[model samples]
Target: MEVEDQIRRIMEGEGLEFTELDVHPDQAKPATLRKTVSYIVCAVILNDQEEVLMVQEAKQECFGQWYLPAGRMEEGEAIEAAMQREVKEEAGFDCQPITLLLIQEQGPQWIRFIFLAKVTGGSLKIPGEGDQESLQATWWDRVSPLQLRGRDILDLIDSGLKYHQETWHPRTLPVAIPCSHVVQRLVLIFSNAEEELWVLLVKAPRLHLPTAGAVKTHTLMWASSLVVQDALGSLYYDQEVTALGVLGLQHHYHPTPGRLQSRCSDGVCFNMLAQLVPDPVQRDRDGEKLEVVPPSQPPPPENPRYTWKRIQSQATAEELFPTVAPTSHQDGQRADIGAATVAPQLPPRPRRLRELGSPEAGPGAPAAGHTDPTAGSSVALRPRTRP
Candidate 1:
């Protein structure tokens, strides 16, 4: 079955609504050219001591050089399945992915999916008789020098460490409803005559960004737009709304009585940055134009709910809304000015499946491990004990 057809069937089975954002042909890279693209999935498995797992390749070209447990994707296989299979085969551990860390693409030809995974079962070991593709698997402190298979992997390792330290954002999903599962908010930024920027603040029950609850039938953006309109009034109804980027992520957790905890127990809030030209059309009851008021002023009686605070610095605005900056490619065109449009359904690209009997084995093969010459250096190799 076609991929899109399969996706549609799954969506239908799950009783989910689908929407597509229209991308102009000129803006979209050609899909036909990407049919031959290859995908590589890598797993970053870190132990409690901040050590990373590495595998040595048996392939002649990079013999004895260490790298992450990674491999190419097989036709008809799911992404998570591919990651599990690679980690099991290369590192000798049956693992489950914790979350997707990164999805890096090079043009339309090469794509890599990096995942953070935790070991669930299976023993670590060196490659035995039938599996010669890998020489060894071991845990490394990541500080010692070993013959690395590729120099580029070091950058990826750094990214993995950074992700482990500070997650770019909380794990979020496009939910059909705003359950306690997720916290959502919208940000409105404006500029004044001096080009100084300000952020809209609400003085309702507390001083906080405008909050919106996601609905079962609408998209997050749609729901957030509604909240913006309702909170700010009709002055912003006709303005184009564009999401700049994610402002920040906050995870809420119930506190324990004695010991401190870091994990969120309640829910996670995903704050989206929205930008618009603050050209107000409505006037106050006194017939005065609704100009940007000082941040300290009490919410005006007419619209006694909203106020604007001048941003501390230009650098602050750039940091919060990086996409607002103009680029050389956008010198003559305004890329940030347009609103998103819903497009008609576009056909899915044709999938190019790898032949079953090709020299390269499918990614679904049984798990195996490798042994490296550097296995003796600070690297620990724990073999699975047989029953």
Candidate 2:
């Protein structure tokens, strides 16, 4: 219930939903760094004059071109450590991450953590005194002509600017807790036309948020939809599952230079809010659009293992059910409907995969056991170490 309360307060106050992790302390997958998954970290740094920081590429492919100070995360290293290391190596500055500015996912296999960081020390890299990391680093005035390695960073720079001027999203960073794989602790929500909202919870796990492990082939967000499909079965096709954004993240890696290890130790877990909406294109046997029945509540999930818990707190419900103008994919036009959305139909159902939680195998957090914090945490128990 502590996890539930934590989620409730955040939703009721900030419109950000916190989810209980589906990841247990210990799991079956080795999830070792570099071997199973790889991550890229990007830094968005700005000066008092609002010039963006840029680094010249030294790597063979994009040599001489400019890009953000970014690089691959090394084995068993924390997210912040990786970010700072990249900045120091590529940009020649010591920095601290203020908050997670953005997260770009290519699925379970590839992920990028973007941050807005402020410099703490070190001078900018110059052409003569640099290693293979880069030729030089400088703050770009935006108006200056610069050859860019990729234009994809243009949006990342803009996101940093928007965040610097005024706070839009909540301030979020990776917590210290260790996880074994790329997993999601999801706040899955369903609502009616009347705006009443219900959250999906796992029944056997003592009524906690549904957690899903990432599949290598699919995007990280697809894990949430996979949860819906498993819970709803045949009804999945008519539903749309989309992950809104991350609320909390966990990453931990201890640096031991000469240590020989049996497995890679890097792990990160993302806590996110995902939505399940009805399919807009519902048709009857006569080819006429059908009015989705009982616009008052969500349909029951077919699997008894999952249940929809109605949010009694109106404040929390409102946060969970934020209003966004629905759009049509058919003609790319505005959806002509109220908040009460239609229900689902899947063109193709993804195969059911096992949940990430399993008996604790090696070291670190143990397997799923109890909710009691007194017993233990990081292994066998849910996270009570909320910072």
Candidate 3:
């Protein structure tokens, strides 16, 4: 009679399709189950100005749909290799994927991996080149809600951008939430070289799905605090921390999750963690702060390496750590030296996700670790170094 019972019976009757099934006890009874063998591939392509390249769908299931260049992983093919091939085939460009962007769900039935890809060679191809769908492909100025086909697509793009940006700048481990359907968390570290890490936290919009959202009615502040506490316990680092600030929260309500994805009529919102940077002033050339360090300046020590994995969204009350609160609060306090600021409440934005991958002299074209079928001898790719 209960959802869990119904799910269990359905699974037993249908014989599981995914590798596993997870059922959690919450007020609403949240469960996540899937066949273990399934995998997905996605590409986040950027142009000359660092803008992204996306594809419009021509498939009947999602006709007139817009999504990052992507497709499903084939049997026996590696995820990374498949990604490289998919992008080249779909976008008509040869790219070397640098990092794991975001592992997210497309809808109730699909899960995907968004990768940051650097254009190594070739130009963007016109749509009618050996593809079945009569779709069009184009590049966008930024990876934001406007670029996405649906509300859910917005989160995927945002998280992918952030992952690409902070891969090498000392980021926190991906937060694992046991939410029923979605696992939402931040993935970067802001280092001021202090005794403690002062990171940002954003609230999870009610409309978005997290395993935690379905079962409990919790506040943003509480969720923010829990993330820090969980980070302190999960990560391997040294330093004490203090909560410096809580920025205002904004909610974008249009384009509900249930609405099927499409190219038009999708809305999105952001809850941001505002950091207080002290070095707001730059030495002036003559007397004014010269416009230097374009926001596009790739993070220092480029081509950082990262290891990523998907975590369950639902966590136990003990795992949430509501009781383990911050020691004290200060308006603007100095953090500990080499302190790692853990931003775990929201997903990292995608264009930002571009820069984080195995250090250059590295790495995707798929089937795990396949060489690019179309990679030319003149275009050199970095070799992978073993640890």
Candidate 4:
């Protein structure tokens, strides 16, 4: 009758192993959860001159000491709204959060969200009406030392600066297609011979990668495993499959025609490479024989949803699987492992694909200006002004 019970029944009916990973969040007992936590939002505002914004607290204990524009979240307020409100009240600037710089949590009792924001409007030192908590709002060069309200702010400042310098990952948002969050996996299934690589292509009105949604209850590996199982049935039940690395990060935006489009208007899909070993029971199957198997509930003939396509050449494989490299023996000697002479190296952790047409593309690309909008450069630091 309960959600978890229903999930268990479905998994048993579908011949799926009922592991902890198959449990969805909604199916969990809310009464057993930990107590609700409080949140503190902080904003790291930087001007064109690379000056950091700071406010002198009016409180007696740490009065006149400088701190970032930060405050505790008010009830019923969103995290972004809290950050913006703090920045306006403490720094006198109406800023827009560019990206989440850092998240610090001491269990669930105290959590802090730090954001890197850019000034959009309002003047410096001119606090919004009724803002009286800070004695003064000013910008600091950071190189010059000032009386800091708390030492923890130093780490936050460093994180903000590093995030501004080099972004290790892209910002992601919840899916806008009638779901708070959606987990979809794109798999790159390869042949056992290593001579060819195969990917599941879905032709649902348009040709695209085969993807499975509604996997928030499972790990990325487990979710991808479901996709493989749904498409290939029990053919790979005895085979060992490992997620190699991420191939790309596809942020699907809504088709709505507008300049102010959100990054995750439609949903986000994580394209990952999965290495599959030949099932001992079907070791003799050739690459052609192991073509993609469609889901049991197949799409219409005109909108075929799953088909396997062999990668034509090694060059194409190299392009698609950039992190994957075939291992070679030294001095041109061949190293034999069973029947296979070469082995593919284990890929490093997956990295998100850089967005197309970015300044990071090439040397001739123009530097991204502040006015250009969108998430800006990860490594380029703004010019500093000597205090």
Q: What local lDDT does model 1 show for residue 21?
A: 14
Please name the candidate that would achieve the greatest TM-score relative to the true structure. 2
Give lDDT: candidate 2, residue 1. 67
How high is each candidate's TM-score?
0.43, 0.77, 0.36, 0.42
RMSD of 4: 16.4
Number of clashes recorded per candidate: 6, 13, 55, 2
Model 3 residue 7 distance off true place after TM-score fit, in angstroms: 36
lDDT of 3 at 203: 22
lDDT of 4 by residue, 200-256 (tens): 555444444444443322233344556556555655464545444333223322344
Could you give me the TM-score of model 2 versus the true structure? 0.77
Better of 1 and 3 by TM-score: 1
lDDT of each model, Cα atoms only?
0.46, 0.64, 0.34, 0.46
lDDT of 3: 0.34
Candidate 4 Cα errors over 4 Å, as ranges: 1-35, 126-132, 172-387
> Tens-digit lDDT track for model 1 on 1-387?
322232222222221111111111122222111243345678889888878899988777677788888887665445578789988887789998765544433222334556788899998866562266577798999878888876545545664675577554333222221113233455566543344565665665444455554332233334345645655565554344544443333332234465344331223234455555433354668977676542332122235576666566544444333222211111112111112122123222211111010011112221122122101001000001111
Candidate 1 whole-model C-alpha lDDT, 0 to 1: 0.46
Looking at model 3, which ten-residue stretch has the lowest summed lDDT?
377-386
